[model samples]
Target: MASFKKTATGWRADVFKKGIRRSKTFRAKREAVAWSNQIEYEIEQGHHDTGAAPPNATMYHILERYRDDVSPKKRGARWEVTRLNQMMRDPLLADVKLSDVGPRHFSAWRDKRLKEVSGSTVNREFNLLTHACKLAWREWQWLKEHPMAGVSRPPENKPRDRVITDAEIESYVETSGFSFKTPPATVLSRVGAMFLFASETAMRGGEICKMKKTDIDFNKRVVYIPETKTGVPRWVPLSTKAIKILNHVLDYTKGTPTVFCVTASQRDALSRKIMKKAGLEGINFHDTRRTALTRLSQKFGPMELAKISGHQDLKILQSVYYAPDPSDLVEKLE
Candidate 1:
């Protein structure tokens, strides 16, 4: 049963049916009648949640669950946890009810975030909120609607298109002493081999840094990537030069299970030092991936390249890695 009555402040709609009792106050009598009708219909259809979330449960409560229970299991768990921690410290969003948050609230937050960070950085943070709200709706049933549905997203920044030249590669290897080195290795020899291997094998810096000796088979000329950004393991073929580079580092990485046995900071610092010695400006270590993929594209088709590069999306490989010279195309046309 449903009832609508005029109150001193507004019109009140009350529904008592199917073991559910709910009331809503509206400014207009017609609004009150409409709300009561909708409530009655929801009760009849058995689609209502009966308030899946407690009215007092704040956004902090929901984020805490996501941070502690969900994010820790993800590949980017640390990053997700960090983002949730930042959100928890926000006075405006931390205390807001999960059910009460709307597009306007998110829009205001986005505006504030824009002032502090670039559009792409803010967009990544916003993704956390969107994913959290979606999980709450699907798994927890705590949210009736995704709070991010109507919110506008920040525009993503364009991907870097920097090119690494072969001449620059020679300069880098020579300056950093990464080119050719005998055994009885130094840190320069080990990290230098890493740079050469990344350039030749088309492996990401992290993948190259985290490589295990067990994962490499010199007889087969293959490097098995046990884990990748796409969550798909892949086998990256090694060139003769790449194989030589690995062999050079085998003794250095012999005692440890890891190939490079270097922290990310150590690798990064060594890369910076190599760059300085090479007299190269604005070139990152990842440019080696682009350089390798671009060279491989000359010999392999899209599918083969994707397999070698561990790219699930052919479009990404084409756009990010394939930077062919226009003069080559012109020469081919001629």
Candidate 2:
């Protein structure tokens, strides 16, 4: 027999038969009912494993299950799914059995990864795998112990202070074939407009890509972000320059619900292409946040800056996003 109940998080399904019990929670009632039905069917056919881990299960198997079952529930599901898929493609990690996986495998992977990417990238990947291992050990019963428990994380890297200058923004825009007179009809032109908008607004690339036309209130000069990286909703007050950029984008993307026609991946790819064409190096789309936040800091106090940047931690906002020129500070002091 199966029973279903609504919980604060979602729906919970419980199945019991022949002295065996299974339970799971899902974000939707349909998913819960489907899982319970599958469990009941397996039990009736005697195919269900009575609390025993599969003999041939591997690290890849655990991560695959996590990617499919857990990642979709997260706010950063797209990035998590992409990274999990990339990790599973590695034969060294994928082929190792769950019982055989230990600190040594991850340690080797960490060292090899450092040679290919930055310490920051390695640390993010480590955090993802660590969580996956923890869930597999505690909840899934796929491992006897946590595989990442013995592994050491890479050293934290210095936070990026790269601030995009006004001249560089112009160069990028010119190289991307966009001008004030031109319509933002092409992907490159739209991406350039997005870059300019980021510098004026300090919105993240993902947030900008997810924006809809209805989110903006021109009369109020505010944009409502329903979903943010921190999972908190915020209203970002707009500047005159930011409003001008929004109006330009609105003109081209008329009739579409989305404010920007480009996807996040397209924006990223086109950004790289335009930057290279402009002969710019070492600057990324995210640097616009630092630039805009730093510029905004001159006009607004720390508390106001935190609200605009969607940063919950003032320490992070000060340390990471607020990069000021020493010359400007000296002038202010004088």
Name the top TM-score candidate.
Answer: 2
Instruction: Give the runs in model 1 whose Cα sits over 4 Å from its true position.
Output: 1-55, 170-179, 182-189, 268-279
lDDT of 2 by residue, 1-334 (tens): 9999996568878887887766655789999999888878878898767654434667777777777679999988989988887887788787788879999999988998899899999999999999999988998787889888878888889999999988999999888876668678898888888899899999999899989988999999999999998988999988898898888878888887588788988999999999988899989999999999999989999999999999999999999999999999999987
Segments in model 2 whose C-alpha atoms lie over 4 Å from true places? 1-52
TM-score against truth, every candidate: 0.74, 0.85
lDDT of 1 by residue, 212-232 (tens): 888988899999999899989
Worst 10 residues of 2 by lDDT: 48-57
Model 2 pairs whose backbones collide: none
Q: Rate the local accuracy (lDDT) of all candidates.
A: 0.79, 0.87
